[model samples]
Target: MIDTGEVRIQLRKGGHLKLERALGARVTSVRGTAWITAERNAGDVVILPGDSFIVPCDKLVLVGPLSGTVTLELQGARDAGSGALTHRRGPIAKLWALV
Candidate 1:
């Protein structure tokens, strides 16, 4: 894919993102919220336990732990490319519980 023009990537809300090794994906980091990063060659599709900052390629420069522990997940909208959100944390069902 070349920069023939301006190609935009969109990620709708509401869905579950399931990442595997084949995608070379993992929980890069997390802070109050979770952060995930997928490889550049990864397919144009992703699922999260909840909402997420769905960035493309290595745009995810920083990913910290959402909670003191680690689970690699958060709740937010899909970031067009490498971005962050301060929404909820943990599974959608147990988000407020975190607080």
Candidate 2:
């Protein structure tokens, strides 16, 4: 969970960060390219420096460096379970379980 202002994070090569229930947050790449994948999303997103992506919903999202080290900035991200829907199981998860 991240506060509203802004938060910066650095990801080493081959390392990743998992963001859960990060709805409406904006991710911006500040350094190297960043690879972003979200649960239920068919395509992955790559953001270069100065680019940004807004989280669509409260789901599991993965962020990492495309190569080498990467720096990212997050804005308007809130704590997990803090959104309107606080249940641990989201609607989709409750409807169907994968594998």
Candidate 3:
């Protein structure tokens, strides 16, 4: 198993997402779909677009993938000041938006 202290999340941008750890997130469940995981409290999760993670493990910081040629989109954090939004560019995002 990957140790939480030595764990690193991968994003499609060839960069790492910014995250902070909480003391008692007590995440006991995490749900991942397709290629990515969404916000779930249980350490940190790496995900791609359209992926959803229901973390019931610990207080987790979610990392999503986003690039020019990527699929799936964790756009929940894209609005307001949630930081850099994870968007599945090109045709995928367009199709998802249509749905």
**Taking the tens digit of each residue's C-alpha lDDT, what string does model 3 give over 10-96?**
235543332232222122212322222335533345443444444233233444434433332222211122222222332122221
The window of 10 residues in a row where model 3 has the poorest summed lDDT is: 1-10
Where in model 2 is the C-alpha error above 4 Å? 1-3, 77-99
Higher-scoring candidate on lDDT, 1 or 3: 1
* TM-score, one value per model: 0.22, 0.75, 0.24
* Deviation in Å, model 3, residue 22 alpha carbon: 14
When sorted by lDDT, best at the front, the candidate numbers are 2, 1, 3
Better of 2 and 3 by lDDT: 2
Model-by-model lDDT, in order?
0.31, 0.72, 0.30
Clashes in model 2: which pairs? none
Worst 10 residues of 1 by lDDT: 1-10
Q: Model 3, 24: alpha-carbon shift in Å? A: 18
Q: lDDT for model 3, on a 0 to 1 scale?
A: 0.30
Model 1, TM vs. native: 0.22
Tell me how far the alpha carbon of residue 68 in candidate 1 is from the true structure, in angstroms, after superposition: 0.8
TM-score of 3: 0.24
Question: Candidate 1: what lDDT?
Answer: 0.31
